[model samples]
Target: MSLLSVLRAELAFGMTPLLDMASISVLEGERIGFIGRNGSGKSSLLAAMAGRLALDGGEVRRRDGLRVVLVEQEPALPLAASLRASLAARGGLRAADLEGDDWRSTARLQEFLQRFDLDGAIDPQQCSGGERKRAALALAFASQADILLLDEPTNHLDLDGIETLENLLIDEQRGQRAAIIITHDRRFLDRVATRIIELDRGALQSYPGNFAAYESRKALAMQSEALERRRFDRFWTQEEAWIRKGVEARRTRNEGRVRRLERLRAQREQRRERLGSVSMGVAPGERSGRMVAELEGVSKSFGVRAIVRDLSLRLMRGDRLALIGPNGAGKSTLLKLILGQIAPDAGTVRGGTRREIAFFDQQREALDPDKTLIETISPGSDWIEIGSSRKHVIAYLGEFLFPPRRTEAPVRTLSGGERNRLLLARLFARPANLLVLDEPTNDLDMETLELLEATLADYEGTLLLVSHDRRFLDNLATQCLVAEGNGLWKEYVGGYSDWLRQRAPPPRAEPTAAAEQDGEDGAGRQARPLAQRAAKLGFNERRELESLPGLIASLEQELAAMQERMARADYHRQGPEQIRSDRARSQQIEVLLEEKLRRWVELDARRPA
Candidate 1:
């Protein structure tokens, strides 16, 4: 039986339809992902399902005795409560409810804290945004709701927290709990969801399979829609001409034919309206110099607690660096220091000779609430002048999917996602050679996130980004900077996964014969043999390791040449036969590059200290 069903629901704001005649049914034990663009009624739909929002016209039916919990993007918790106390309070379980004399409660709380990396026993009120998210997630999971509705639950979470949540949702031991997750996180969706449902034009439709499948289907659908739109345009243009001729002929019999043409034109307009487009414009800019930004012995501290210490890093043109760490590890602070928002206590910060950097903060707090979209994009110029006599503000707003009517709306009225889009539009409108983004994927739709990824990939500049979106990091980051103990920063040669693999615990060493002899003799005999082994690479492997870098560099140059040749190939002039050959060659090049890159990374990591 279906756990929940929405029948012909209609939700609107003023005269705008947020959702119209949307009906959906979710079965027990189903893991569904709710996806849509920003301001596309995803959150509203979830709210309606959870019965937190009134539906204008529809009925929500739930199975008898089913318990539902809706977790919002920003969870609410009492400010005074400690992390442990808050969890217990929201979980509605007394110490006795847990098995064994309060020990179980304590153990469970400690486990949750440790798993989330909040092991310090800090007050909940003192926790960072990411920590708060973890606490809320712990409480939500403990609730054991039969049906869970999550709206952007991963927004403030770090990579570790996100992984934890994914594991919790996918655990079979959790029983028959179903979930409706509204998220822009493609990776999270891929990991946790079994079904994909898209919200479009106030209606819901299920796409068979997971997030990846949905993306493939969505791309095909978009291409088909584009072709249909072109055909519709041609027909409408021809029919309009015919209707004009009939009206000029002054024939009474032609009146009915003209009316039919008018109806046809209206239908064409509706079809056009259904086609979604985001007008992103990339402004041209001078190429950045070799060095984008540099930091040497950078350190930051507050009240003797050093957040970032002795950090040294360099960003170059065409570099995509992902800054990663647990909450309060000073990932954002590093960005701020680089951007000159905060001054480091000790170190030198430098930028390229012609650097033009743009920073996108986590909250998008740079956007002004008192201003309109048009004003925000072009503050000093008249709308008419900037837009080439048609109001550039409107054009800019339109690029971010903001309607013409909403151009004059106050920024305060915009949703979090809308604000993010607007901020992006503003940033892209201005030329910059270096981009410093802090959590750019937060509040963004999946489509927008993909668009951003593609844009950054194609961008001929430097990018320093901090994001918990694993897919984004995988596709974009060429290097990684992990914040570690005592404000130390470690640079990894490759991406996030590479960092994880390298940081994994090394194999346990077997005790040496001398150590065993010492133990047998009841004396601490020889640390010398163990110390000597640690000081030197095993004699058999030392020479080969020294030559690995040179070998890897040679292979890399060949791979680069192959890539360049493929890029230069003229596929447009190729016949079907040639096209097949060209595709095969491209795939071969890609595989070779991947193989060489992996080998190079492995060789580099094995280098002697």
Candidate 2:
């Protein structure tokens, strides 16, 4: 039942080994989730399996007549072709060629197009990032291949799109097809993967279940290792004591014991080397005032597409905030606005006098492809000065899994995940009061993402994060900011899922009075839903809508002024009583503002067609 088998694979980037002595087999009906830290050769192995990349060592054996297709992050399509035409081209089934053969081909093409919300008439070139990703997925799902290899399939998918894709790729009736996916979406992996293949340190380990099961098994293995280590140490201690007893006048008869002692010492060192831990904890820098940053009446537009408008917000000490939106929805623009990198069309942005900000730009624009990894951190030096401590460049790079021997290699040769790790190392090395991260989770593996969450949790500085990783947000963010790109921003208290529930479309607005009278009895119509009762504001909704802009502006000004006052050195030194009172007042204003904003979105959704 085996579909493919990778036997004793060995791969290295230059002299830096990637996959070493790794072997894995792909069996029939297996949905394998390929996972590991960044730059662990997951992509390389996938390419090797598809015969796209030549393997440096080890042969890949496939079942005869196996049809394997690898779908990458970007859809490789004819730019000028219409969406429908592209699908036809990928499926190899022309409209005319499909005469009466299989109508299911046309039916499936239409279903996938609709699921992705793609307009068939539009050129693929004109689609947005998410749209292109969806189109690629739709094509992959429509292919005739028996084995599908997907890379970061959820990169640009929205929540609904993700679920729809989950249904398609991880169905209960998987038929004869099998798949392998590379993704950081924990939920997606758990829902789709029948097995987990982890590639790390040039080694491969296969777990027979999903991510959760893998964690459980790994924990148990660690527990067993701990016990074994203790036993080995105890036994080695006795042998060491005997060996240290001078070996009976250095006699040749003691050579066997001496060799046994050396072997035990080597074994201990090997274990320690395999279990080494890396610390990414931040160094305490200059503490900022209570108020970090504030924006008032902020608006930005690109060629009449209003990305943000009339937005106001305050950032206080220790604020871990996340910005959520679809691709191209101005999340990055908002980050720039906070940092004052670009002037908003109209707004006032204030940054604290002591604010020291560190930005992790998702675009990876800071990296120079021509520069070596070591040179990126220190121009010509072998160490970096972080606050009062000097960290060695080699050691620092090691923390991010960059081998010192590869220090001379250019940055362009690194994988997507490795680039992200390099960025993190460079950014976190500088002590800062605020950290602004844009899509930091894009190419990271689940392990790296969890480590990032841990680092952020331990960080004392304020955080502004823009990401689509739901797990990361729920763990690290204290508040959520939803940006809808049409000049709309909403703040929710909990994580992404909480925000989803808070915004779940209210049940179909009660039918019109005429429909209620004609379709139901008077008594049934009278028993209206409580949730609907508040939304049935004949003119109040409109009036509230009219006054919201001004009211929100007023509330923002009041809160910003108060927070700025409280940020003063003397004001913060005035003890906790005054601080509590000001926070209470600000919280009240925030609640009132959120309620009004929720009403605004509801009224907008209820607007007449």
Quick one: best TM-score, which candidate?
Answer: 1
User: lDDT tens string, model 2, 316-365?
Assistant: 99998888887667888888888888898988988876988888987799
Task: Tell me the number of clashing residue pairs for each predicted model.
Answer: 1, 1
Q: Which regions of candidate 2 fall more than 4 Å away from where they truly are?
A: 1-29, 53-65, 73-75, 78-80, 83-107, 120-131, 158-160, 201-203, 226-277, 346-348, 380-382, 506-609
User: lDDT at 485 for candidate 1?
Assistant: 70
Deviation in Å, model 1, residue 308 alpha carbon: 3.4
Per-residue alpha-carbon lDDT of candidate 1 for residues 448-509, written as tens digits (9 for 90 to 100): 87778767877777888899988788768999999877888899877776687677564556
Q: What is the alpha-carbon lDDT for the whole of candidate 1?
A: 0.74
> Which residue runs of candidate 1 sit more than 4 Å off their true CA positions?
79-114, 117-127, 172-174, 223-272, 297-300, 339-347, 383-391, 501-609
Q: Find the 10 residues in a row with the least total lDDT in model 2.
A: 270-279
| TM-score, prediction 1 | 0.74
Prediction 2 TM-score vs. true: 0.72
> Which pairs clash in model 2?
20-202
TM-scores of all candidate predictions against the true structure = 0.74, 0.72
| Residue 306 local lDDT, model 2 | 91
Candidate 1 at residue 87, lDDT? 59
